[model samples]
Target: MRVHKLTFAALAVAASLPLAACQSSGGGKGQSDPSSAAASTAPSPSDSKASDAKSPAGQGTAAATGSPANGKVDKCRTDELEITAKDNTIDGDPDGTVAVQLKNRGSRDCTMSGYAGVDLKTNSGPVSAKRSGEQAGPAVLKPGKSVAFGINYPVNNSGGSGVRITGLLVTPPDETKSVTLDWPGAATLPVTESPGTPVKVGPIGSAGQGG
Candidate 1:
């Protein structure tokens, strides 16, 4: 009887061994989930930084295209002049001061004289205003290069309604090769003189306030 009992005990112990091995091999309740483990490791700082950099605010497109200091003229057609207006400030009068930036993204350099000043068109006709700087061109802007024209005027009598800059004329110094610049529309920027203000207008040719 004793010998038979000992053999039975050994057989029971052997059966339990397989159960232990199965549990160790992920067949048990405490088995690890691979995906959850990876998430817990956390992402690196570099990865987080890259995501933030792609944001629009970081790229400086919060309002318009191009640099914040300058206004960008969009969709300039071939053979037509392009002007982008920026930094508009209207004081007590509707007509204040503004900076008109011009660019010659064309193949050939734009050699012109007497570029047209900004005009406020109304029902009667085009209301002509004077810019402090010279319209005289020959301001030779190479391909992809840009030049700015500083203009200051009273916001008063700027057409009781909306106004368009209309067009620009490029009269070359050598010959009368004139190029008509089509207006892409107008951008109304707030007028402010404070350091933190978006639009600032000061003296001409004072390190960026140039025409």
Candidate 2:
């Protein structure tokens, strides 16, 4: 009976050794590979931080480009300019012209471009003159600089039987306010009308170049 019991114990121990060896070999081949573990969990905290840091910096750069102060100049104001008027009529030409000038009285440079608004006052009402001739480019008026424009109008020839001149309301180019000045046209021949005569205004330019 003792020899039988020793033989059964020997068989059980031999069978259990092969099963333990198979489990160890399976663990090594399936899940315990160092290359697989490293590839699956390779993303470090530094990798996430490096990608996340660029977003805020890119947004800050985009916000800085939207600002609008790139050193552009502004238009001239009426209060900063002193206006004057004089007759500049040519004798040979049928039409007569009055030169309206604007001098910058301010301390800094300002832009004056386009036509001046002119209205001739009569006993009936104000006659708005239409703009004529070529448009001048933007003229930068420095401190104490002056620019002039012309108001070419019809002349009275039939013994003062047309519109009598009183005063003129002149608005500078791109300005809101206006100044009142005496009529600079001839007093002898006030502004008269022929069959197809119209009052014309010129662009703002240097001195006599306005017409």
Per-residue lDDT tens digits of candidate 2, residues 82-193? 8999989888878788989888889988897889899888775787888886858988888888889888887777675577778889998777799999997955335444
Error of 1 at 144 (Å): 0.8
Clashing pairs in 2: none
Quote each prediction's TM-score: 0.34, 0.61
lDDT of 1 by residue, 1-211 (tens): 9999999999999999998888787564586688888887878788778788788566677556544454333333334445565544543545455556656668765454443434543333444444344334245566776656555543324344433344534332233344554433343323334343222222222214222
Off by over 4 Å in 2: 1-68, 188-197, 206-211
In candidate 2, where is summed lDDT lowest over 10 consecutive residues?
188-197
Give candidate 1's error at residue 18 in angstroms: 99
Error of 1 at 52 (Å): 69
